[model samples]
Target: MAATGVSANRLELLQIADAVAREKNIEKEIVIEAIEEAIQKGAKSRYGAHHDIRAKIDPKTGELALTRHVTVVEDDWRPEDELEEFNDSALVRLKDASKRDPEAFVGKEYIEELPPFEFGRVQTQMARQVVMGKVREAERERQYEEFKDRVGEIVNGTVKRVEYGNVIVDLGRGEGIMRRDQSIPREIFNIGDRIRTYIYDVRPEAKGPQVMLSRAHPGFMAKLFAQEVPEVYDGVIEIRAAARDAGSRAKMAVLSNDSSIDPVGACVGMRGSRVQAVVAELQGEKIDIIQWNNDEPTFIVNALAPAEVSKVVLDEEADRVEVVVPDEQLSLAIGRRGQNVRLASQLTGWQIDIITESQDSERRQKEFAERTQLFQDALDVDEVIAQLLVTEGFATVEDLAYVEAYEISDIEGFDEETAEELQARARDFLDRQAAEQDAKRKELGVEDGVLEVPGVTLPMAVALGEGGVKTVEDLADLATDEVRGGFEVRNGERVRVPGVLESFNLSQEDAEMLILQARVAAGWIDASELPQPEPEEAYEEGFEGEDYMAEAEQLFEGSSDAGAEAADDASDASGEEADDASAEDR
Candidate 1:
């Protein structure tokens, strides 16, 4: 049997091991091992023994024990060899000699009672520290594993502390960080505030587990809607798009697959009960719910809700929309500070320009007036004739000359017979005017004659006019290939200048003129094909040199100072009469 009776009280060591295991929640076996190692170390440090020692606690009765193993030394062994030999030394000494023990076994177990041990305060404190550190490490690992996969979930927490614009929330299992940017603006959070936030992210950090929470996240709004609106959760309604000026206003488009279910009405609930709940959660931020649309113009019109749209002109090339509204609805459509239209633009992915009814009418009128003025100045038309043309829906000289008599008769006042007569007289006048203009052209040695063609299109005319090509001479000067290509070539791969003609919905002649104008503007043709301006015949023919020369000679023969003196005398007489009249009245 091993000699264990002399070791420290076995019961006390067992008690300590049991206590540590329970306190640290560690396995009893682990505590038993730790106790044994500690006892072994303490024995070696204090006993000065160069022998193998083992320590153990009795599992059943809480008893502890230790044993020592030593070498056998012969009586005749040297002192050094006697102590050094682990098994046997021939010339060494043994502490106890028994001649009766004839088997001569030497380095073996010796039974001796070791003294009882007492732990100093320092050792007890050291043991306590070791157990605590191990426990803490285990706890941290447990926590990290618990919260690693819960991001995007909504969690309820109590506000613990506010520090430097950050709020620390106390979740039951672990703490979460609510950063300043994640909190709703203007929201006041004090200690003990019960708040729910979305788990924005879960990341491992140096201190422990990191759980990031956010109240301002877009998903938070979606989650709130999901909770309050049964249709959203049940998949009957879908949020098509959302745009927010966070903390103030937000716009969302909702659609319903079930034709009977009104998505907006469902989300709003009865008298706005559902939406109000979401608003309260969002710190009273205003939300606008608009009906989602599949049609682009209709969708955009709905997106800018509360503002009625009379017409929406979509410019596909620019990805823009021109919205026309009545004058009274313009301000409402644009909204205060243009917030409605701006958010609508963002929602619809189109640049929107809102124009009122009156503004558009005024702009059209001004454009017509400008075109009339330019035509009148170029044609040298009499004012009365120009007014008549304008009243008869032929504002410009080009319109009067190029439009059919039947078209003029269709105007309010004129019948077909009157229009025909008017057309004949105008034609006769134009013929005479053209002769005079041709005579002047001959005088200048310019053979290119300006004449009007009713068949030419407006696009063709504008194309020619912008190019500074006036008559058929200008048109003939352009290369045929260049003229044909101008009508077909696209500018910037998307915008065909000629494509604008179709958008006008103009007549065939107007369409041709549009193309012609574009070609002329591109410098593919000359203006000589277009109508030419009349000659300066009236100025030349109306002048009588004889009368003007007679008047000039008379002025030269008269006294120029006599006229000046007469005007001076007349002014003095008027002043004297005014003074006499004032005296008579007095």
Candidate 2:
């Protein structure tokens, strides 16, 4: 008879499959399918040649059954097949002898049944190994799917072990890997210790799901806040931005949709209880909660908490900001390694260059001193001349050099010879200043520093004197042509200023550079150059016009519709054209 306990073994195997599924958190059907495939492979290898074989186990009863394979033989081979079948196995026999083929060839194949011994001890062991492997693989796939989308979410787990500074967390379903880099420095964990972390990432590999956990990400704090704050969870309070130096400190900008609720106060809780809890969870890491702002300067001031910003100078062209703070708050605003300001820059998406009030004043003073020294050096004068000019209100190079020597003599206690000396000294100083200014302007792609020859007509000189446009530096900084109301041309050609060469003569490059700068500075002009008029006495020019027309007649006749339209258009187009034109210049 067959092995009487085969049914018992099958029932035990089914129970083992169910237990494995439960232990691995996999579906029982997966284990069942694995076992079925394993058994089919083993049976095919053991009995495929002689007969078709099938193995199956009942899901409900767990009963194992086996079947044999067969094919009908021709009538001519009937007696031979019956004899061969009887010889093939003691359990095999031809049920219909008259249907067998007597002349069946040697190569012809037939069918027969073998006992359960077909999958004997060796084959059964191989099948069991395959099934176990497949079951483990299925379990890993299930675990990966469960956790992949869970990144950035908070998860709680017990610490199973620590190896080389990494914690192995038992996350109920599987062990998640928490790398040393992911853990806050100085944090400690012991076996069976319950800890909270973020599911930072999940990656699938040949072995299993690699679930990465993080305790130090800035978002970890935000996620925890959401869990703790009902308003955040319900979307009433929104976290506008967050920056962190991981375990040491963090800053969060928050805003509220509900004006009735103060976001900062709400997040802090009464008596600092709520924020204190978050800090406690972070193991004493400091947190600063600030009000979010759309204005960069206001936002930056908030980001540099505890330090008051007196002013912000935004260089929008460079996407940079210079923040001025009180003298006492310098160290606070800069922090260690400029960490405070750096975080503020990162938080606000602007490059911040910070200076204290005293520091800025000192820097400007130093720059002015250097300019004065250069002036004295070029003029071969003593410091007294610089001091005298500075005392007499001729502080800027443009003021002293470009205004004319007569103006210097006009000051009390000044002789013509003294005035001439001062004018020469001032001109020398302008040349030096222009050289330095041009270097800076060239560096900024604003202009090429070139000095203008001292021979241009008084009108052209006055036009150039409107802020000392003799050098590329001056031109590069010109107001946009639209703002100036028209472009200035010299001799029917756009005036080009030389860039970054000491030659006093205006080259084509210099003229082009000048026209570009004039366009920028004057805030007016077209693709073509319009002749710039010589400077005349402002009062005399207007007085001559007044001589010809009465006020009412001027209002009616002189105020042309075209002129009004042009003025309005220029006003509306001023800054916009400058921005676009500057971009094109770049």
Candidate 3:
């Protein structure tokens, strides 16, 4: 066929397609498809907008074909609405269509050949726009596909621009953004500067594919260490956990698979070469490389290095630990602005409370006295017997009543007969205590519906009743933090105020379950309709230069008082009625 007036040579079309595909980093087929669509659009404008125009290009020969499709239908079957959708030039009746082609039938489509028209300036511009838009879309798809799996990997880029603390990076293939908060604190970048960052996320957006880079993320530090240390790269040393205060300090726990290789020494390298390389890249951030241990206490002790730990008490139910350090090492263990203990907690996945040896001793003595008094009052035992029970680690009447007779008998100065008598008294006292609490619960007018909620113990109900949360609706109206344990401002410092369930010594999981049940009972939602709470992101530790010596002194002085205050808060939450019964029983 002869070339049309506006048609390019077949070789030119093939060359343009190849050049555009390479420039856009997209498949050649995608570019050719876009070219075909643009030609089809131009053809429709030339022939008639209402006519169905299609175009195709041969991959091998670059031959172009343009055709106008005419649908054949019965004259009577053409509804007015359907006829309005087409022009007379686009549709043909079966009988009339068969005149042009001897065997045309209803439901058949006939292709009509037409000479290509010359392209006008407006049509050429429109075709250019269509090709550019399609190419852009294809480029974006290619960018997303290329970088999606690259998330969590480190990439090197040159700074393209810095806009309001956010750095735009030219990542060789595509552009990436390092948001202001994602960059290490106080770290600066200038245009054309070489920077390395972790590709934390890749999102396809309307404008283009968004690549998110981060330097402050803990994973970024881990990746840097893996890059610097050969043992880490080879899996001989594993990075168990890492916590950072970006641009200030970081803590990483490393475990060695081979017994001969020391994890911490390997990470540090010979003469501190490996860790120093990572530290320099992070803008002089101090890093602590510690050996990881399977035993939690040993791991925690290692995490809080440069300080001697006198004692470590684990509260498994609460997932908290109490670390008692020597008086001289208090400042070191707590670090500047509590950074050491906080990072240790994050690395170990536990809440840590650090106190000095003196504070721990004082707290222990006060606890001993309180337990002795509690046992004496609840079990109607003498001071001598109470002391013996306390010394045996029986802190409550429930503990005494639940233990085997032989276990209690093993206490110094206690025989099997005395143990049996103590057990009986303990059970009787508990029964009387429960009866009294039930009476108080009724007197406070706690709703029966609130009582029916699962996980709501009698003590929790009594506390809720006293707090004016009388019905399931009232309970459901409480916020999650309020139901769990809200915060309070004390001496201008905000601290958590133990909630109703916490006052009863219930676990957080139990409290959440109670709240969920209350929500269901209040007709607020079905059990299946509850939304899962999103996991909280780990916050980077912040460092401030504080007077650690003075702060440690203050913490030591208030350690026992804080324990007493918490106990008093718990007592008040359970109601004044229970306190009077205990006083009378004693």
Best by lDDT: 3
Q: lDDT values of the candidates?
A: 0.66, 0.70, 0.83
User: Model 1 over residues 11-47: C-alpha lDDT tens digits?
Assistant: 6656766776666555666766665665665565556
RMSD of each: 29.8, 16.4, 14.3
lDDT of 2 by residue, 1-586 (tens): 0212233566775797788889888998788777766766676667554445656677777766655544443333444456555323212233343236664443344554345544566667777788889988998999999998898899999999999999999999887988998888799899999999899789999888899998888789998889878899899999988877777888899999999999999999989888988888888888889999988888888988878899898976458899999988899999887888877887787899888899888987786677677557666767876666665666666677677777778767777798787677768777776666555544444322233322232333334534345543454454434213334588998765432222333444445445564454444555245444332322123332223133223434455884455344444445556688799869
All candidates' TM-scores? 0.42, 0.57, 0.74
- Once fitted onto the true fold, the runs of candidate 3 whose alpha carbons sit more than 4 angstroms away are 1-5, 72-102, 105-107, 315-318, 378-382, 401-428, 442-502, 507-586
Steric collisions counted per model: 40, 36, 0
Kindly indicate the candidate among 2 and 3 with the higher lDDT.
3
Off by over 4 Å in 2: 1-13, 44-115, 118-125, 313-321, 336-339, 349-351, 366-586
How does model 2 fare in lDDT? 0.70
Q: Model 1, stretches more than 4 Å misplaced?
A: 1-152, 172-176, 200-212, 315-319, 363-586
